[model samples]
Target: MVAESGNGVHLLYPVDLLNDEANRDLIKGVLGTVAERFDDDDTKLDQSVFNAARITKLYGVVANKGDHIPLAPWRLSRIINAPERNAVVTIEQLRALVPVAPAKLPAAKRRGNYPAFDLLDFLTRLGIGYRQDMHEGRERFKLDHCPFNADHGCGEAAIFQKAGGELGFKCQHASCVDYRWQDVRELLDGPRESRAGRATANGNRPGEQNAATGTAGALRVTYRRVSDVQAQPIRWLWQGRIARGKVSMIAGNPGLGKSQLTASMAAIVSTGGLWPVDRTRCTQGNVIFLSAEDDAADTIRPRLEAVGADLNRVFVLDAVVESYTADGAEVRRAFNLKNDLAKLETLLIEVGDAALIVIDPVTAYLGDCDSHKNAEIRALIAPLSELAARHGVAVVCVSHLNKAGGSDALMRVQGSLAFVAASRAAFLVAKDPAGDGTRRLFVPMKNNIGNDQTGLAFAIESAEVPSAAGHIETSRIKWGAESVTVTADEAMTSQGDPEERSALKDAKQFLIELLKNGALSSKVIRADANGAAHSWRTIERARVALNIQVNRAGFGKGGIWTWRLPHTPPNTAIESIERHTNCAAAYEKSGGLCEEKPKRNEPDWEEF
Candidate 1:
């Protein structure tokens, strides 16, 4: 289909494509090849409209560019060409028309004496007319008048910054194709004399201060001793569960409120609300959310509003703009962690006081990296952790638990182990095994900087948020109590099933008592477990939890596996179990889960 856009003609290419990164590349490639093939002075194809988020001029719209005069009149944009049957265009058909496009402009090389150049500041000083833009990672400034030739005012002339921070100038006009940034720099700022002459006049040695490294020359590395560093305490966001300037994660099975937990945290940070566990008031700041799973309008915003979030302080990173043309054209695409960490850092810096950031189901932004590879996952997440630390913001990533039931709680986080390893703290959200199914537990999976916290319980409850049209219903977290003794490892195997929890508890107790005195043959342990109504599976789970040592006795046909407790005395082992059981019994009898709020009289969560 084709239409008149008032200012320019619009050509719509309907291709059989899924809205994804790969198809975006394909569309851009086809556009580039077609533009190169159809180059002419009469009309030019707008290459900036290749992004998936590019907005097009709709048919039958009144596009007004100037006063409605004969010189530059307003025009009605209507479909000039159409087919009777609006059939979808296939990828194969698009590929058949694609040809090898011209190579991109080569990146400008940097000299050892590249100065710390600020393009915008320099342009402002020169009183030059320009429009700022970006494409990929490069910053572009389209000059209103070409520096080489003032007569060429076409939008093809630009000054841009490359990824390595070197400045360059380009003008597509045939009269100025050979000129470079050095030429433009010399024209703007006088021609450079000998380096030695300039340095001697400035009272500095050759390469005395490198702009990028801030050293005499290109310094590769710097080392420091541990004694020279001062120790610092961990800055807690949610006391023990989360830390400021750190990356933490929450993992859980489906329908366990993992995303809701992150939304709750964002609300607290935005509104300076009190934390549920300690009742400490939070420091209010802006929050950034990059959620791929939930809809921002219906799912995310409604939940935030229901929980009394400061909507003005909550910002969602909608898309990454790759490029912008002089005529207000943009190429926008989805944000990818593997490719856009620098962009994310730029955003954090722009926000100034970002207290928290939430990335729901980080797998959606992994890009092409293999999520299961430890090295790749570490390489991707380490920089994010560092960015969090550098910006002093709490980054909370939501993840789904693997389907590996009865496994270690730490190992149950989906994808690479490095996810849990790289994070300073990680938590698991699961349904409470000792309470009614309405209650969910947020328990620690691993914590490196703080003492273990007693798992807290909360329930998802409906809330009515006032809106322009009456009100809308959404879910918010209603925290139950903080002194729950349930661990994530315990909650995982049972998953709100009281019978399974009891059986596992019984199996653990049976093994602890039976193996406390001495070693026992595996066969005998299994038979005893069966006779005691505990499945062998449950007994094996208990063995793993206790970190039992397995020894081999005899050889050949008489060989057997023996299970024994690891070196701890029988009394200490029994004491641990008894204490744990007593705590659970005490918590249950207090009716903590059924209460709207934890009793203020009870010990605080940090006291645990």
Candidate 2:
């Protein structure tokens, strides 16, 4: 048995430190010490004892007189039963047995292909640690210390080396001349550099040299002739140059036959007929007329037939398919332009392309008009515009005037100003101020893409036509008109009370005189009436009292206030003045003068 101070017992024949018996006895003593430290009932103690016995047997430790003897199971059993009291082993003692010298192994047996020492060095730098499992007599490498080791092993030392420690161990192979750390690091870093070089040379790898080069020369190129191209201006086939993709508001009092006139226009376009415009002809193409308010069979079909529209060319959507529900209430949904565009694409695939798509009364399709929210409205209409542009279809969205009457123009549309702003073109339909009920006026309110100054005045008549079943059908017409007029008191009293009538009468007279020349400043007029100290509140009160029309003109320093006459006929004005004068005379006869008393700077002369 070989022994040294602080070293555990080593049973060896020649007492060689590197002999199998020395290593086995040393491991046996360590395992015995571990078993004693733990309780007998502990499963780990029994497992450690069994593992140490098996490791000793594999290392060729046995009691026999030969160069290599078969390990004896009885000898191991005896050592386990009569464990050495003072000869004990610890984690530190087991780790100290690991060979630190590369030349320890026989030089003749060295493998030429052994990894370099830097490889191991790199691994240690990358936070690798190791432990020797004396329980199995095989050195086990671990990234952390073995908790079972009583001395805590080399865990602290290993961690310290990983954090920038230069200390390193020779390769485990005794003949390997290189250090473990240097060989390992060189192997890892060398291959990485080679891979990077190959990738750069390829120039096709994603997010590499190729990507950078490709983006460097990315520039938008546009071609144009040096001189202006001698191209003829393309004119719209429709008379009066109906601009492409614009909203034309067609409004009238509830029963002014707006729908009938719109149907007539649709019929002319569907059959490629002439519109009222002299120089322009209708751009003959397929026409889609969506009327949510009218039934295809009863109202729409007969009207189109009476106007001599080609039945094959005109497509009327079934009311059932177009209906939608909002807030549990069933309402005729307005034609969605996006949906119609998709449907139009399908239609084009089947029957060439379409030229016109008309949506009557855009309000019915808009689920929420009273909502002041702008984003919601834009989201809804954005799809519609995209559809029109994608399909190259001219969309004519029809809208109605607000109940509030004034300028029978685009400004009177029922919803947000965005409605007019979004549309490329817009028109307004109003009762002719000079004609009777027979005459109607179609005024162009906004013409962003074309001229819209002149309006079309036509007399409307419902004519009868024989259908396929021989039934008489009525359709509206566009004929010559005689006159149209709406009296101020008649218009006001038609809906409101006597107070409204009086207010409207005074307002109409005041506006007619003020706007007869042009627009006038409300501030200037107010100052003249109420001195230089006149307040805006007083001006507003006078506006309400007199019922004059007022609107803002500009902003900041350039801002001004302007007034205009309500859009009413001259006869309506003359009649309103006469009625107010008669009412004042009647009040005077009844002992209550209705006339305003002149101010101190004014003359007071009364005349009927």
Candidate 3:
């Protein structure tokens, strides 16, 4: 087949000659003639080649030769004339032949032991072109030859030069920096130098690839082991403990000298004297007394003076109740002592460090004592505790005993158990039932930080009394039944008789009446009831007999003592009436009186 070109004819062999070396060389000679002729007109032959039929013909040629022939013309031509040529070439008939050399491999892939520049010269001999420019927008200029001149026209032979042991060419123009290599092997055989991974078209990883990159392993936590020598130091509730910061509850019934003891503590702490504990002393500082129950001018000042406290060092905030609110309803608001504590902070800052802050009769500052609400109680003490901790001051809160008392456990405290639970240490005061005018301040009803079995027992002597004038004395005593030995027989014998029980009940009723008006010291009330058939000891015995409990006031001058009813009087009365009233009519009315009363009555309602 033949195709026509602008100046000559393109002869296409009906048989694919590219598979035959003789035929390929013949075809190249014909094309080279065309190229030489076109060179005069400053033109070149346009070569368009396809491999579709060439591959099929190459297979048949290989089979006829009994082995595949190397495609390169130089290698194939040598093999064609060998002694085995008869066995290979005689099987296939020559359909057609053209005058052309075999097509060369791509220059970049060509390989030899020669240097790079020499190999590049060989590529120019193969009619390949190479050009370099400064990459102006997008154009390249030729330095050696003008394409418009026929004498120096572009062609494989005109541009390429064969250096020693090399077969490519370089432009000789002084300004031309362009050069073409004869072999492509140098480009392909060089190191790839690719990055670890391929970049996407938009230069980011795919979402899944990003997720893989973002994956992380689990984290580990480390804990250090500490030796005994490196352990944190423990704090005592008394020594530096009290001074460091602690909320101490000084509780007594009515007047077991709680206020007076608080006053003395204020005086001592203000003077930097040792507190009357187990002989252990605490460093003292300024004292602020928030006494809601005492008169500053008439009561606290005189009492503090009597105790020999420097009035200047002792600051008595006797008007906390008034300052917080006027009406008792506002008393709840007073329970939150934070605002008042702010003033306290200013005072501390002004006066230097304060060692102790006292809030007497804590019930007055508490929101609601009867509710037993934990949150209300917590709100009441949290700030106070915080203030103490913040300022490194000992906060002493005075509380009263509950009506239903027993051992100085959480339940015995006046308000919610949370009150005692929240405190660092709680001291309870109850009068000595034996009429010694001495009170027993139970160690701790509750002590979160220290021992609960250690407490102070002291006698309260009034300086105002003629016998005790100018002298305030207190004696320390200790008595508890934790390890006393009593035989079973002795215990049975000591039990009270029925008459004694009845007398105890009467005494209990009297004590209940006294407590209704607020706590009264057992000493003062005992003197008032001196003539009554029941002695203080007998009353106390009856209390124990009937399971009635009382808290003792600790020792100090003017230390007031008080008591609480074992049970509600109305309930007790109703119970007693139900048990005693056994007449048929009274028995029938028992259900109504003891339970609920009926609205309607019958004709026999009054009969007994």
Candidate 4:
């Protein structure tokens, strides 16, 4: 019979069948053949309805999906067509039409030496909620939550106990694809602490008596002598900047290419590329990047691709699978550094060749810890430091710079000083003092494991990377020349120096007089600034200070930037004024184009 299934149609085949194994196999093969033959883009055959005992929707029933949308209105499901005489599909015809041989059955479950333990009793003892039901002649318990990773919100996992006394676990989430019955079995029934091997609340085993001693009830502390300890040399990821088997931090203000800088480092490690400072080849390995601020697809992946990173070697730890709900639902949440480091360690072991772990803006993963408290910060970082050292991976924590002007570079890190103290090396990303605003300096703030190294300058520039959705625009780091002399502190100091302030003041006056006749192209202004023996950096600073208006004149390849003094009338024909120390004399020299003071009711005009 052909029936309308509300939004679509369903074809039903009636067959004389039994609930035996042979009949089930025959029906399964027939359904599979029919599904494969008729499946298409717009319609799909329901493969899950092949079981002989499954229920079907009754004809003439109201098939209201209750979506309450115009496209999915309620409809009556009824038979559309029926044959004059019902003819059953023959099992021999189905066997003949089978397109390919049936797939091989799974190997028999290996019970081995595992004892028959009550699964329900075990789950209840562990305080795990579950709903029990029968599935395919076996007892199946739908877990309230996924035991492997609670973060998965979908309810598609269950624990089934077969009639043959075999246990199985299955979760439909892609994240839990690697999970097996053995993993869940171990999770629920940890190490078998039988009636004999279990330890008591005190430091003694059952039936054991403690002798009378002064150290009774005191915890046991073990110590090793220096002679028994083996020593090792420090390994460097980037010599004198980032060290392997240790914690490192990179701090900077926003828009300083901190993320791009980390991506560059990841790219180097992923592809075994050369370091920017030292031209040494790094060990090719996998990288785990946990970014809380940027999206992996649009922001992180494009940057990695732009830098020619081995995309396969780069992994993003987006979130931790926390737990599962009772109906086989997964509960996922953010990866907290405090509680999830153990989980991260487990992942690193699985990745095997992981050489780097980057936690961008480490502050985002602090997880309720007081950022400014030394004790809490150290407690959180100590294990992370040990994990990195144990795994021989360099963990770089990206952080933001606090607005503490003229302070030491180490002090400018946004959190407690413990972050820098715990780290073997700390670097600062600051704007380069010698270049225009585009250049940035990656200078050392503190280094305890390597010699003093000169800072490297880099610029963030836009690049096009091919993605599934064609090309996209994203920024990547372009490493420039090394800053052999200037450091982070020196750069920060010069930015606020009185002498530099005076030079910026001079540049502003020069810009006003140069553009007094109206807008001038940026190229002309820069060329004049260079001719005046002023760095383009200072001139750009002056422009920002004066709120200069910059506009592009054309589109695409022919576009050019034109700079105008803010509020300057377009095409105004005004006389130019000579550079002078006396502000009043310059105002008179320009026919009042440069104003020393505003007229009684007029708005203020900037001086030359």
Tens-place lDDT digits, model 2, residues 1-608: 33211112333222224436556656544444554465342243322332223444323343322112122112321232233455444546664543343222222221222222342445566554665332233233443532111122344222112111122333322122222333233323432222232322334432343454554222223357957767644245354445434333444445666777777777777878877645346767777777778888778878888888887887865433454566565554444542454654566456545767677766566543221223333444556666666655666767765544332244346554446656766665556644464666665666666666566666666677776777865757674433223432222223334454455455445444444534445544554445534345444544554456666555664555666444534343344344434444555587975463222221121210
- Cα lDDT of model 1 by residue, 23-83, tens digit: 7756666766677678575766765565667676777878774335443467888998986
CA deviation > 4 Å runs, candidate 2: 1-237, 245-253, 277-279, 319-335, 338-340, 366-372, 389-392, 404-408, 468-470, 481-608
| lDDT head-to-head 1 vs 2, winner | 1
What local lDDT does model 4 show for residue 587?
45
Query: What are the lDDT figures for the candidates, one per model?
Result: 0.73, 0.49, 0.48, 0.74
Q: Please, what's the RMSD in Å of model 1? A: 22.0
lDDT of 2 at 368: 36
Candidate 3 residue runs with Cα over 4 Å from true position: 1-237, 240-243, 318-341, 367-371, 405-409, 433-437, 464-608
Error of 2 at 181 (Å): 68
Error of 2 at 132 (Å): 83
- All candidates in order of TM-score, best leading: 1, 4, 2, 3
The ten-residue window of minimal lDDT in model 1 covers 596-605
| TM-scores for candidates 1 onward, in order | 0.50, 0.43, 0.38, 0.48
Candidate 1 runs further than 4 Å off = 1-222, 324-329, 496-608
